[model samples]
Target: MTIRILLDTDIGPDCDDVGAVAVLHALEKLGEVRIAGMTHCTSSQWGAGCLDALNRFYGRGDIPIGTLTMPGFLDGDSGYAKYNKGITLGYPNRYQTEPAPDAVETMRKVLAEGEDGETVIVAIGPLINVMNLLESEGDLYSPLNGMQLVSAKVSMLIAMGGHFPAGKEWNFEMHPASAAYVVAKWPTPIVFSGFEIGAPIHTGRSLTADLPDTHPLRKAYEWYVGEGETRHSWDLTAVLYAARGHHPFWELESGTATVDAQTGANDWKHNPNGNHAYLKAITSPSLVAEVLDNLMTR
Candidate 1:
């Protein structure tokens, strides 16, 4: 079955989100999955613009993109993004100088148009847009409320957030209320790639060595964390599970994951029928790094 994926990301702060996008595109080229759409939960025009530029690099400039009303950023560059800042390429992008569409509407339209129980939503950053999408009401496209729409259409929600076993991470810590609400009330099953799972497995070193100078991914990687430094495969791991599932790369720890009210630390209680599970890294980090390197270079 072709896994249809809708990606929600906060791509500017880290390079793995860029790597994850490259992985998803490579999978799509292999007919392993379909790119339904992408949304940004961070408020940076340059970030959205970079995503558009990357999509164009993959020859998918036409894919729908949306940005949240309240992005987690205020008024500064998120280290990278500004991909087209210093370079002068005849690149094809719409958001470099243009505005992005409303992300909630984009989510609604993408979900409403797809076949029920066939679409997978992978969120690799903060849960703002997903939370917004869940709490949103019906409009011109469907009669169902946000919760009802997700129940009818989405098959699964795979999120890369939380530092499981007890710790506060950026994704949940940024917005605890939304994270708590999503964890408790989301309609579909959730699989979290916690802080520990993706920390050891690294990628992006190959991109610095392999990809050409003119490539946008290479530029972004180089700009994000300097050349040749491998970034933790946090977002990439989540996208991998979304495309392939936990198999040779990782194992599943099934449980009910709850977020602490104030601290945002996560506690997972083992339960077989629980709607939640976390990825336990089983594949060698070096080996997984090789796999991601191959995908990143693609």
Candidate 2:
């Protein structure tokens, strides 16, 4: 059976999300997984359009797209237009003009359609969207509240955030309140691809060489890091592990993780009843980089 994945992303901040989406589409093409839905958690208005363009590029244009619509969520523009204007302009997508549905509503609708304990949520961004979903009440999409719907539908949450034993990271720091709330209140087992796990793995050099300039993925990389330059595969590793469970490439360390809502720092304790775990690299970073690069280039 193909694994169903609901991807929550903050695509405008970094180019790695582009690679992550490319990796996901490659896995889908291989019949290993299916996209359940996509939710954009950033304040950027261009995120949904960028995501739609990517989906269309990968030949999965029908995938549902949603965006955060909370007032004053990030107050100012999330700078998505500045970061992803190239993508939205270069690609053909209707989301550029017609906005996507609310993130929580889209999340609820997608979770409602999944079998109990089946959908895997791959969050390669901030936890704001997931936190809002957890705090949301029942709506037209489903009678179950956020917590109930997640408990009934989602199998696991694979997030790319935080630093190991104790430190800060971008995804966690961007909105620490949501990170803390989700970590404390979420119903399913939580797994993190922390900063240390993906920092050593550099990719995108091959992506520029392998894919044509017309490819949106290639263009995203070019826009972010210049032609043929590499970036750390933070989001790519999370998606890889989310799509393909366990392997020698990485191992899981079970522990309870806590986020300091104010500082956005994270700490882990080896609790006996801990429901969280983080990825630890076992295979060489070079080998893992090769694997990810191959997939992103596919």
Candidate 3:
């Protein structure tokens, strides 16, 4: 059976998110997964447009795209808006003019519509949207609350955040409170693909070299890392493991993970029965990059 995936991303800040979406689309075309929905956790106005443009580029233009509506998230003016602008301007996007629904509401609707224990959520962004979803009360979609709905529908959460045994990462640090809350209270098993797992595994050069200039993936990589240059496959790693379970590429270390809400610092303690686990690289970075690049350029 193909895995049903709901992607939560902050696509504007990093080009890796675009690569990640491309990887997901590639797997989708191969009958490995179905992209149920996409949500952006950033406040960037162009976020939904970027997502919609990329989905359209992959010929999945009808996929729903939602954006973070909650206040106090990342700003609309991000340094990476240039790439997002390029995508929205250059590609065919419906959301560029139509406003997207709230991320929390979109997530709730998707989860409610999903089969029990079948939806895998790949979050490659800040935890704000997720935190809001978890703390949300029952709505029209389902009577079950956020945590209950997640426990019922979600099989696993594959998150690309944090640094290994200890340290801070961008996703976690961007919204520390949400990270802390989600880490402490999330109902399902979460597998984190940490910074160390993706940092050395570079990609994008192949995508830019092979894909046409009109392709959003090529444009994103070209503008972010320059033409024929590589970038870390951070978000792509999470989406990869979410679609295909860990085997040849990685190992898992089960532990209790904690993030200081104030500082965004993270630590892990070994616990055989813990619901949280972080990925440990087993395959060489170059090999993994080859796998990801092939998928991206496919």
Per-model CA lDDT versus the true structure: 0.83, 0.88, 0.90
Most accurate candidate by lDDT = 3
Where does candidate 2 have its weakest 10-residue lDDT segment? Answer: 74-83
Q: Work out the TM-score per prediction.
A: 0.94, 0.96, 0.97
Best model number under TM-score: 3
How do all the candidates rank in terms of TM-score, highest first?
Answer: 3, 2, 1
Candidate 1 lDDT, 101-205, residue by residue in tens: 888999999999999998899999878789899999989989899999999999999999998755778888877777888998999999999988789987887
lDDT of 2: 0.88
Q: List per-candidate RMSD values in Å.
A: 2.0, 1.5, 1.1
- What is candidate 2's lDDT per residue for 191-291, written digit by digit as tens? 99999988999999987678888989988888888888999999999899988876979878898999999878999998657899998888889998888
Off by over 4 Å in 3: 76-78
Q: What stretches of model 2 exceed 4 Å from their correct place?
A: 71-83
